[model samples]
Target chain A: MSPAKHPQRPGGRSARVRDAVYTAVGQLMGEGRPDRLTIPMVAQRAEVNPTSVYRRWGDIDTLLEEVSVAALTREGDEPPDTGSISGDLTQWAQIIVDDITRPQRTRYLRAMVSAREAVESCPCWEQRRGQAKDMLARGIERGEVAPTEHQVLDHVIAPLYHHVVFGLPTDRAYAERLVGDVLAMARPADKA
Target chain B: MSPAKHPQRPGGRSARVRDAVYTAVGQLMGEGRPDRLTIPMVAQRAEVNPTSVYRRWGDIDTLLEEVSVAALTREGDEPPDTGSISGDLTQWAQIIVDDITRPQRTRYLRAMVSAREAVESCPCWEQRRGQAKDMLARGIERGEVAPTEHQVLDHVIAPLYHHVVFGLPTDRAYAERLVGDVLAMARPADKA
Candidate 1:
């Protein structure tokens, strides 16, 4: 996984432990020996005391789950409001295209994807997705987009994700092409 | 990462060694420790002796590269002609949807994806993509599809990959909705 999972969220004592635990796990992952990983080992590295660590995270699986959520929830680029869904989607998707294209971020992105499948219920993923949906919603509110097509996330974003998963280029030109295809499909049936 | 990286390619002496190594790696991947994996360990497990394994594979990355090609190349589903590109695509995608949805295979699929990004060439990926492209080409030849818009893989397949990556259900109904979306996007401007 990439070193940077999420933008650090501000918090108090509990957040500090979470951050420490995050560091500990990140270091261990870098070392590359999950099989040898133990809760105590993480606790030792985090300097958080074993009992608290165990109390907070029951097992490795839960710990990883939380970490994944944290990573995905970190601050990210917001969807553009170019006053049109097509314009907004292109700009927004390009941000993601750029983000995932980064070698380091791509690793974390892939890690987050796999980690998401390991269990269930990642609020960060939901939050991220919600933002995408909101862009479509905004378009619909202005009547620039059909209400039926307001749920455009699956169409535009999914293709970008596919490129990322396959190690294919998700550059500006690629994003532009994909967005164009989607927009072509998005054109009013009578207008095309 | 997945055991069944390739369909067993028919050959002679070296093929046997490849098969043995394949089995050994498969068993290791089953235990879930690609990071901890060593060439000598694989060699011992395959009973091919360290020298031969070292001489052939040289390193874990190269060894894994070969294994991935094989796993991806493994004889699997065939894309049905189905008389129409849409029909053929629906059928073909459903097979992938089914293959990936299986709990056990999903693990291997994820591993294969991660391993894929770690290297350069993966012929198996190309092969699967070729099949998708073939469906579009066939549609164009039949004049059932626009020759100008044969590149349907990115739009259609990407959404399916999104579903697969997210561990979402890819039932027949879901497949139809996604396919319908793509078709809608594909429709000529006159047909609303």
Candidate 2:
């Protein structure tokens, strides 16, 4: 979870403090269940005082939600504009695989997932899905396929996360094959 | 979890006791994290007395392992010999979606998943995967496309568990689509 490459955020003392907090959350999550995390523990790890952490984030749940928002809002999360939805989706999926597969970041990613599950819908997750939808809309406009929501997420996105979380077959091959399957399904039915 | 189905097992006093214990484990899991489970709590819930519970199972880990074994061993879990592997899989996947969707079973299934993740590895889950492999073997023997292990589990099976655990898009249609994608992948590429 302690990655030198912080996902996003520019330089400033306030940003440093926020990065420290998010890092602490990621580190702690890597160790064990998210349910067991507490503000005091996170503050101690962040080297920030408990009072300030609470004053800013209010509670563990809120802190996690805000951090997730930061992770997804980074422009890096968007698929490259490779001129086709499937192309963009494949690249996005590969980045996701790479992101979670980083040796130091795996636990942090898992921890974030566990903690996010405990909270209401995270803004970052919602925002990511929205980005996917926007790409799909563009694909429809380009006459690639009729736009649909559930299939892409269910077939392509869901399986990737499942592999990472369950310790199943995961790697570049898994990501490529998964993208292949999604594109296979997303290709529109033949015209009469 | 505690469904009246009792899955599979001959009737007897010993069987009744085992069933009671499994039911208690499920009930307790629904209430809280599995690591937090205690013998006294299970005993109180099962009405079997703490000493007897301890004497039979030895520990929480063993008890959970045995319950999962019972679940996977149920004869009903077999994919019906519906003339083809894909036919059997679609039906089995549908049953899974329906089983988890049952109002009474939702919490029970979630509890079982929570408990399974806490133990070394879930016997029922392993057994289920084994079943998928066996069916695929039959497909290969029948001159069907050569099937590999990860594709079926990764593409076909993992998504269902992912949906259930994450509370993502879940419905009969989703399961059907998932199975369709797997079959489409499993099909011989040269056949296209």
Give me the runs in candidate 2 sitting further than 4 Å from their true place: A1-20, A30-35, A44-59, A72-75, A83-87, A103-105, A109-118, A122-124, A134-149, B1-24, B35-66, B72-75, B80-90, B101-126, B130-152, B180-192
TM-score of each candidate's B chain against the true B chain: 0.73, 0.75
Over A1-192, each residue of candidate 2 has an lDDT whose tens digit, in order, gives 233244244685557778789888877766655435688998899987787678777887788767656654554655566778878777877777777555334444444444434554546546657767877888878878633555566666667766655455568777788777766655444333
Compute each candidate's TM-score over C-alphas. Answer: 0.80, 0.66
The clash count for each model shown is 10, 0
Instruction: Give a tens-digit lDDT track for model 1, residues B1-192.
Output: 212233355675568888899898888876664434678888889987777777677776578767755665454545679999778877876776766565545555565556545556555557767777777778888987441332456655667666676665557667776676677766776643
Please give the distance, in angstroms, between residue B48's alpha carbon in candidate 1 and its true position after superposition.
Answer: 1.1
User: What's the TM-score, to 2 decimals, of chain B in model 2?
Assistant: 0.75
Clashing pairs in 2: none
**DockQ of all predictions against the true structure, Cα-based:** 0.42, 0.24
lDDT of 2 at A25: 81
Off by over 4 Å in 1: A1-12, A25-41, A76-78, A113-117, A146-151, A190-192, B1-10, B30-36, B73-78, B146-151, B190-192
Judged by DockQ cut-offs, the docking class of candidate 1 is: acceptable
lDDT of 1 by residue, A11-50 (tens): 8666787889998877776554333357888888988777
Q: Distance from true position, residue B134, model 2, in Å?
A: 6.9
